[model samples]
Target: MYELSLIALIMPLIVGLLAGFIGSKINKSFTHWITTLGIFISFAISCWILIEVFLNPFLSFNQNIYEWMSIAGFKFLKRVF
Candidate 1:
């Protein structure tokens, strides 16, 4: 089981952000298409994750992408489970 923690999760967010940035700079005609494409990709990834979970009975795979919060010596991982 492979967990999509680091690169996988951030890609869609980046795409959406890029779309918004470009949308504001350009005309309104292409804005909807770019936003729609980003949403579609995000939906597709979610579907794939659901499919992987459904196929595997013992799904305990997790990947720690980053340390989201740190207080003193404690480290919190942003994990995909």
Candidate 2:
């Protein structure tokens, strides 16, 4: 599930990068299709995760990637969940 969540999170970034590079060297329509496909894939994964959460209400997904700063005992956490 976390893997799927990662894919859903990263798909658009990867797609946008590839589309930018490919579009600059090729046809615009091809780039459009590539981005659309990426979006669909991400959306599908998100929907699946949503369904899973609905079915199993006890499931939890939380990731603390970094603690960027601690200022005067206040912590800034970067989380992905």
What does candidate 2's lDDT look like per residue over 1-81, in tens digits? 989988999999999999987778988888999999999999999999999999999999888999999999999999975
Note the Cα lDDT for every prediction shown.
0.72, 0.94
lDDT of 1: 0.72
In model 1, what lDDT does residue 67 have? Answer: 94
- Residues 1-81, candidate 1, lDDT per residue (tens digit)? 254533356667776787778878887768777767766776677778778879996877767889999999999999966
Note the clash tally of each candidate. 0, 0
lDDT of 1 at 49: 79
Query: Which residue pairs show collisions in model 1?
Result: none
The alpha-carbon RMSD values of the candidates against the true structure, listed in the order shown, are 4.6, 3.1
Q: Estimate each model's TM-score.
A: 0.58, 0.76
